[model samples]
Target chain A: MKKILILVVVALLSATGYGYYLFQKPSKDIATTKPYLSTIAPQLIAKFGSGQTSSSSELLSKVIQVSGKVTDIEKGKESIIIVLNEGIKCEIILDKNPPFVKGDYLTVKGIFSGFDDMFNEISLTKCYIVL
Target chain B: MKNKLLIMLITITVFGAFAQNKKVTRTGSVQFLSKTPIENIAAQNNQVASILLVNEKQIAFNVLMKSFKFEKALMEEHFNEKYVHSNKFPAAKFKGSIPPSVALDKAHNYEGVEINGQMLFHGVKKPLIIIANIEVKEDLSISFSSSFNLKLEDYDIKVPSLVKDKISEQIKISVATNYK
Candidate 1:
């Protein structure tokens, strides 16, 4: 009876360990290499907004480069907005202020993340000031 | 000279009459929801694009999709990337007519009328019917409120199985606008 109880306890512990492993595992498949420049475009990035907001996790931390003509400039309390065509805009929040104006052609590289409801904004890890 | 003067007067009167009755401003709001019952979503491009009102028989509303906003950073990210996919399609529009029995007066509150129309979201067009309480208050403000369902699958949105129970099949939407 003692040996049987010990075996049962061990089996229960192993089952609990396996359950925790599945729960804690990361769902995302992170890419070691940086995303190709050609793959990043205003049109391509805009396609990400077509589905449910919860799916953004799949694209988080992925490097992306987007190019578009600046339409408007919004200076906010914590960030700046660079608007592209067709009401598509990107908000860049900085540790320090970055100088930019509306209508300046821009190419930004950052990690794609979601922001204020229904917004797919990029957290700019690095911004390339391309005229 | 007299005939020319008469024609010019007629033209001016006609233009003025049309302008007085024209429905100029159109605006709306789309609320975002999660399973947690949080009601804090907004849009940046919150301008009403176009409107048409003819004898209370026809009405239309158009909204730019880029305007929705949220409070939390993570929620907002999921909204655009996972839910709205605003990058591919940029606009949500409603075109419909009001019930004939409802009268729109420049003064006095109008009864809440049922608006039947087609709602275009994520490039897919679907039939949408909403009840809106619209009033042309003091010849200035146009107040409206109508909540409707937004189906995810209608626009090809695939909700992951893990969180499927958290989201509703039809999202409730409310809209309000004031003329410029």
Candidate 2:
């Protein structure tokens, strides 16, 4: 009876530990830098969808840094768009500063927040030019 | 005098034809880097071949990132979530030009030319130069291929150390586009 009870307790502890591991957030070390020239020269980067889906909210509030050439920089009434590569473009809704120019080589560091699906944009809490 | 006028008109038409030939389609591709190769990366705006367009000296291309596809659901998720973050950054574009000496009529041979343009990714823009091979076919289709190295961190693409080598620092891009 004692052996069976100990086995049960061990199993409970292991399951709890595994559950915590699954729910843990991703490490920051995973973020890496890619050169702007390398991004466009041989590869094509573009947006994924129409942004109509209400997903990606769970990843909001996470800090990120991306480097690339500014293709189209639009300073809207309340937001900004800094396109990365032909395949990947990020819409940063600025709470502080204005948008970048079309030719500016910029490095943006900010949190990934929610965006409008139709327009394809995200609300940026903090953004600073790196390059 | 009438013959001279006709000759002058023919000369003008010939010159115009040469100028028209100078302007043609530029083609290329976008490669996604992961330990495993992902297939079927699609762009919604297929009507426009490349990311941007270039005429004489001006350039512009439009690409819908949301349309790009990957075979694996997890990789696609990581691409939009971890690498590209498609929700925040919706599209990628380029506005630049190729060298003047490169002829668009060249057939079946790799014409190495310098491509200079602005590459926008993950909400950042930077000037870029790439070596590309331009191939002109009998059908008047233009195809291009080039390869370059990229670091994920420059654009804030986070990949955990555990799977670091699984992804390559430099991604190779192969592209082919036909005029519509």
Candidate 3:
């Protein structure tokens, strides 16, 4: 009887612990998570270049990895947005000391935010250089 | 005849520049706050793209649902999957124009100017008018800011009855962007 009671108590404690853990869980860490899809910069740009992409786009909200060449770099207030092949705007956490130029080939990963037709670029946030 | 043609060409070029004076920004910010007695929820997205047609006094904003970052992972996931359905509605957009008399650039500051436009969100289209504040800096950059209350039902965003009190039925949205 004592052993069974102890087992019940142990199960209760674990359940409570798990509940706490779930309650305190932080947001997704993009640096450590695996990307849902991978594509070339130009291909991705071509698919959404029309600027008419709606909810039907398959890559919305998915973390995607892209391989491309650097075409432009913009320094924003908080992040450095590196444009891949002048199409994909990959935002990095470190805004200072931008390490990219006009012709560097690179691989990057981030959440596929959306296509900004006004700016003619696809945006990625929380980007990390995969190297 | 050659001198007259040259004058006509110069006039056309000047008119073209005046009509197409546009300003665009990619690193715009939009933030929303939901408050209730039980809990106050907030999220912000900085990857907003906005364009200002200066001469026409027109503006538009485009924001991706996936870019909104919440404090808690589970709350954000639930917001995207259940509330807004980011998979089905990836973006929320607004396209509107201000009145010609507003004179968006002639003055250094203006407050409470109304802009009427159509807003598309959660696959629902609704007419929206924003009361905004505008500031023209010495460097000729313009700063626009606005805040408004958005009703959940207007966008067809339904919340479960159990979680109703935790989230406000009306969310306060704040938008700010700089065009240089």
Candidate 4:
């Protein structure tokens, strides 16, 4: 009877711990997660090139790390966006500003949401600068 | 001969500058508020891609469903996994043209503008017209803001019967962006 009671208490504690973890806030540091890393030039060429259909099965809804030159930096009221190679756009919403500037060579890590057909570019969200 | 070459170069440079006046922004924000007797839910997506064609007075915006962030993790997950089904229809887009009264080349600070466009969301396309306030700064950057009401039923977003009262049928949406 005592062994059974101890087992029940242990199960209860683990369940509570898992419930807390499931409801925890989304992580902001996606770079350290070792996402699918690639260069900005190839990513853009594959997506926006005239002959390409942007049908890459490898990139959809995956965490990606892209490195390129920072072409634009937009500091909006809600977030800071960094455009790499003039096309690969990433926005950091929740995290504080990283130490970077326009023209700096950097790598951004975020989830590759998808290609914006209208704008003809790859979009990444919840992004943070890795280097 | 030198004079002719210089004149030719000047004309080409001037034309090239005018043709490249388009401005774009990716940090645009779209926020929606749902108010019901039981709860008030709001989500904001800051990773909107948009462009303004200065020559044509046309504006286009594209945003991903997964980019919308909610106050609670559970709410965000339910929104993406259950209602919107981000895996199937990943993006929402708007393409519209502004009125002629809002001069693209004018250096005015702010002007009231009308935009008529088709909004594509959840694999459904609907015609939408919006009244917006536009700001054209001296630096050639453009900013605009607009608010509209969206019906969840129109997009086939189903709210479960169990918590029907917790969600609003008509959601209020507000969008603001700055293009540079």
Candidate 5:
């Protein structure tokens, strides 16, 4: 009976450890994420033109892949911003610079946050350069 | 009628040339920090859009709430879902004019000014007065920096009793931008 009780306790401890591991798992990589920029940009522009603020509900908070020419690069104190196609912008929250430079075609995967009403721009966050 | 058309053309061309003096940047940055006894929380947003109307001494900035990135994923989620409710209030904006006391000519190069503006954030509009440094580069680029502090409660951000110690009552916000 004592041996059986010890085995049960060990099993319960392992189960809890596994649960914690799953709970603290990092987010999935952007390469595995879906929905490319070609589809998202037009939708965002359409919504902006129509004066609709709540149109892209399906894309919000979801990791998406976006590709475009780097029109401008903005260096921040802590991060970098890559503006694409004039209106679509991604915020890369990292100390290091991305591999590409301005005018280079690149693709990145990031979380689509929402639109900027004052600037009429689509905003994404926590971006990772995929290409 | 022909002379009137010619005069209108010249006027449009002159206005277009004058408007070219405006400097704009879509990738400005704004960072905020919250300090408390238990922890310090900081988030930075790089997708800040700023326009400097050099001719008018007016500046405007727009930043999306969802663009702010936090170090911890869980904390970021909590900020968007619980505190900011980013889906409801999408963006923050400021429209201000540089004080006339500061000069922006080539002779001055740099000036310190108090920008009096209206800030719109979290579905509320408040009057904001921020002191900032502006440098006009030889290349015609403008560099700006400002820091200000504000209470979270002023924007209707509520802190739960469970993690009250982890969050600060007043947060420090900094804005830095380079426009061309």
Candidate 6:
């Protein structure tokens, strides 16, 4: 009976521990995660710019790797935004600041948020510089 | 010589009008707060974008639901997957115009500007009037800010009874954008 009680107590404690861990789980680190697909910045920008709103929803939340030349870099309070090819906006949320300067050819992996018609640019979040 | 001068004057006028009429930005900020005794949840998205048509006194904002990052992963997941169904709709947008009475050409601080427009969210389009404080600087860059409250039921966002009490029905939204 004592052994059974000890086993029950351990199981209950472990269940609570696992629940706590899940509740405190951090956002997905897409930098190390394998990308769904790869493409260049201009091509992605063109597709989304042509009023292909449906495709944006399809790619939403999926990690993608995009390569382009950095055109503008806007450093915000929380993260660094590297504009690619004068179009795509890759926001580095997890990694606060990246060392890449303007005109540097680079590759980033991040979750595709979607196209913003206001600016006509593709948006990425939780971006991590891969190359 | 007179004709050439007239042509030059026309060209200058067109170019100056084009340069001063529009301003846009991609790093606009939008924040939402849900306060209840059980929890006070707030999320801000700096990735949002806005456009200011100074000539027409028109303003519009676009923000992806997935862009709003919450402090807790579970909360973010629930917000995207269940609460908003963001994958289907992806974004909430507002396309509206400022009152015609305000002079947009001159640089001045305009307060309590009523923006009348339609807000499209959760695939539902509803008429929304946002009160904003707009500052038009000498350079023609605009600093626009507004805060408003929205009821979850107004947009057909139904929270299940299981967590209904925890989440407030009235969600406060704030927007700040600098158009350059």
Candidate 6 overall lDDT versus native: 0.85
Docking class of 3: medium
Which residue pairs come into collision in candidate 6?
none
Question: How much DockQ does model 5 earn?
Answer: 0.41
Instruction: Give Cα distance to truth, residue A121, candidate 3, Å.
Output: 3.3
How would you encode candidate 5's per-residue C-alpha lDDT over B15-119 as one tens digit per residue?
876765677776788999999877889988877888888768899998888778776667777888899887778788999989776555453555457899998
| Number of the top-ranking candidate, with lDDT as the measure | 6
Report the C-alpha lDDT of model 4 over A1-131, residue by residue, as the tens digit.
99999999999999999988776766345656778656665665565432224464356556787788888887888888777886777887645675788889987788777666655667788787777
Q: Indicate the worst ten consecutive residues by lDDT in candidate 5 chain B.
A: B103-112
Candidate 1 Cα misplacement greater than 4 A, ranges: A1-131, B1-5, B26-28, B35-45
Q: After superposing candidate 6, which stretches have Cα over 4 Å from the reference? A: A30-34, A46-58, A72-80, A93-102, B1-13
lDDT of 2 by residue, B23-122 (tens): 3332223544433453233221121224222235333454445434344445545766777777678666656686776655555655566778787778
> Lowest lDDT 10-mer window, candidate 3 chain A?
A48-57
Model 2 C-alpha lDDT per residue in residues A7-105, reported as the tens digit of each score? 999999999998676545332221352222222311322321334354444434455555666765543333344555432345453576654567677
> Please, what is the whole-model Cα lDDT of each candidate in the order they appear?
0.56, 0.50, 0.84, 0.79, 0.77, 0.85
- Residue A44 displacement (Å), model 6: 3.6
DockQ of 4: 0.47
Residue-wise C-alpha lDDT for candidate 5, range A23-128, written one tens digit per residue: 4655445556674444444554565433334556556788777677787777766678887776777877677777778888877788887776565667777788
Instruction: Please compute DockQ, using alpha carbons, for every candidate against the native two-chain complex.
Output: 0.05, 0.03, 0.56, 0.47, 0.41, 0.57
lDDT tens digits, residue span A1-131, model 6: 99999999999999999999998998777757888979998888777755447776778878989999999987654677889998889888644456778999999998888776666678888788889
**Which ranges of candidate 2 are over 4 A from the true structure?**
A1-131, B1-29, B35-61, B105-108
Better of 1 and 5 by lDDT: 5
Q: What is the TM-score (0 to 1) of candidate 4?
A: 0.80
True contacts kept of 1: 0.00
Q: What is the lDDT of residue A13 in candidate 6?
A: 100
Between which residue pairs do clashes occur in model 5? none
Q: What CAPRI-style quality would you assign to candidate 4?
A: acceptable
As for DockQ, the candidate ahead, 2 or 4, is 4
* Candidate 1 to truth, TM: 0.53
Q: How would you order the candidates by DockQ, starting with the best?
A: 6, 3, 4, 5, 1, 2
